[model samples]
Target: MAERKLLAGHAIRRLRRQLGLSQVAMAEALDMSPSYLNLIERNQRPVSAAVLLRLAEAYDFDPRKLNAAAPGGGADAVRRRLSDPLFADLAIDRHQLEEWLAGAPDGAEAFARAYDRMGGGAAPGAAPDAEAAVRREIERWRNHFPDLDAVAEALADELRMGAGDLYGAMAERLRVKHQLSVRILPAEVMPGLTRRLDLHARQLQLSEMLDPSSRSFALAEQLAQEARGEIDALVRGAALDRLGERMYRRHLTGYFAAALTMPYARFLRACEASGYDVALLERRFGASWEQIAHRLTTLHRVGARGLPFFLLRVDRAGQVSKRLAGASAAPLAEGAGTCPLWNVYEAFARPDELLTQLVALEDGSRWFTMTRCVRRHGMRVGGVAARFAVTLGLTTGAAGPLAAAAGVALEGAAVPIGLGCRACTRPDCPQRSAAPTGRTRVMPERETGASPFGFAAD
Candidate 1:
């Protein structure tokens, strides 16, 4: 009973104190007897709308704020919080829990439990079944294709084309073999056509306003579909997690197309010459920042030169769209991709802005990242369009050799950024939506602080 009533009791007491309202004062404001207000504030009685309305009317408080003071987790809040997957082990009545906590104390305690359990092993005595399965399958695939690396190596060697040029080949293939014509219609004519591979007519058309880099990327994607069979063969008889398989297959196909245009050896040489400057590489290969970043991470495949690279992309929601590696073999899981201080989130507020950040991973690995927002297919004869941000990253240690010979210092450099509000642990981040459980907030509490969570560095 005490466990069940603790959060509500805590909330009512806190609210009363924060508002500087005494039991007598609150009773008068809500038209209730002082004893009744005391009982409710003590969790001896459930908060009722009558009391809720009275408190609001008298105190100028939002009713919802009062509700966050509820007990046992609100039904909606619980459901939304459990949607994070970290709470899989708990036998929670999500709806009931959410409702119970609804409009009350915001379940700050529950959030703390969720965070504590996230990185821990699964329920007692269970052998991390999902992770084992994922690794087992990936290993099985690796063993089956002793020659898999050779195949990627060979293909990487053969396809020495640039992104634009490789995509152009695909466009040519569509036109010449399928009798499909490639056209650059204005955003109005084919507002919806971001690169529709019209199988019926064998045509691939895109908006004329499409940026050159995007045009190339779309073309490469189309080429991936055309070469799907060859890609599927690379992973034949191997086990892969659902997301892993999807990413691997798609990665291979796109890589094949990139290899075709950029060719391995030549591209590596150029990367070295350009000091791996993203913009310079964009101009050199006629690829978008995304494609260049993708290729940079792929440089770790076997015989290719230089340090390993990890590529990550985040949108406004802090959702990672792409995560791949050039050298480091970090496990790929959706939940693990977020870090609260990864500067990628900042790029969204300042669109078309390029920002740099240095991020330190949990294990002490540090990375250098460049972030910017890039959108495609916004205007049209008529349509709702697509907008997103693409953040590129590489290791500071690995970047030294690959970067051009220019005199800029590249060591121990990074820009700080966060993955998203829910996943990041960095306290005192003004942009945080909710205070992550356990971590202390560094920023001073402010009435109108720029950061949503009212955080500052300690």
Candidate 2:
């Protein structure tokens, strides 16, 4: 630790300000001259181990966190962001990034954020917005927050309800402990809102339109308000913008609600016993297939992990609505429109049934997928059922738990699929909607080919 320089100028400044102590006050407390502290805070001088210890002692922080920072993860992430094709035009080097991070942390962050969303939208690399960043984070973490999982599990123990009665238990807990009564109001009375907390009235009002599962979910979200300490800790660690923070917080709240309903320990047991049967699990837990698919992705607790599943939701227009990734793999779709070959889109045709497919990507990875159409929990869209198709997929071999139910599916031929039409290069795909970039379209005057467009490479 003493051998290497620890340039924590921005962190030190933040810590000092967080403590509400001025530079001179902090320097005096740390037994250092104000000028020297200023130099350290400005990154003109490296903070030594002794100074780090003194700062920790004076500010009640862990010195080891600073010592362990190494090159600072921010610089590394910025370098990776620069490497993306979106930033190919920007010629930012490592040294420049380090200096920017050290000298003007706030300005550097704003610049990086601006650079990330250069042209806006999810067209190729233009999507560095809070939603996309949170999506990437969900994929990176495999949609599982262990600390939140533990908290949900402890709460589940407190609720201690049987399979179908978790809702009543939660409501009762809210009523008895929090002095909050749960009231189901008509849609006309609640208007478009599904759930609202009236603190003055001590009531948690719910629209009568919400399904039982969604009502339980709403209560769980309210219950999650009390888990803000852990949630804030996790959110702060992410370092998101205002919108990004709110998005992540909402996602985490939903996660807590799901975990509270299923509870990791029991959910895993039910999953194993049922061999990943979505319907059986839905019946057992009184959750929708959508909710069951979501819970399946979160069984990544250490020493008791379930199969790492990938999940995605797509509407009839082939627009992606929800995306969840496996512990070992990235999620399926990057943008709204995805490959037409996947059964997630096909499931919409048979809305009530579970559809399974074995698909092989261009990369030679075969995934066994189970897809089903699901209605949105509590709301109608365009005066119709807000329906979406959800899919759960994992590597072919790892899907052994689903062998019996998905046996015929596993035995089926692997349909070729790609990331999406915009990013895919499968020239021979009959379902190809648009020409892949860098491919010259070839035409035959006298004959029509299997695909709408043929590439010169073909």
Candidate whose TM-score is highest: 2
User: Where does model 1 exceed 4 Å of error?
Assistant: 1-170, 177-180, 185-191, 221-229, 238-251, 329-340, 381-385, 402-458
lDDT of candidate 2 over 1-458, digit per residue (tens)? 54457777777887888879998999899899999989988888988878877877777887644522323235644454454434434568768887888778767666555644542233665545777666644544557788788888998887784434678888888988899999999888977788899999999999998988788889998888668898998688666788889999999999999988898999999889889888888888888888888888888765788988878888788777677764536325333246888777777679888887778875567888888888765565556677788888888878878843444656558888876765466767888877655456888889788787776662
Q: Distance (Å) between predicted and true CA of 357, model 1?
A: 2.4
Candidate 1, residue 344: the lDDT equals 64
* C-alpha lDDT of all candidate models, in order: 0.53, 0.74
Q: Write the per-residue lDDT of candidate 1 for residues 328-442, one digit (tens) a residue.
A: 4332222334655556667767887777665664334566566777765436545545556675555666555544323436655544443345445455466567654333555
lDDT of 2 at 208: 91
> Which candidate achieves the best lDDT against the true structure?
2
Which 10-residue window in model 1 sums to the lowest lDDT? 137-146
Model 1 residue 196 CA deviation (Å) reads 2.1
What TM-score do all the candidates reach, one by one? 0.53, 0.73
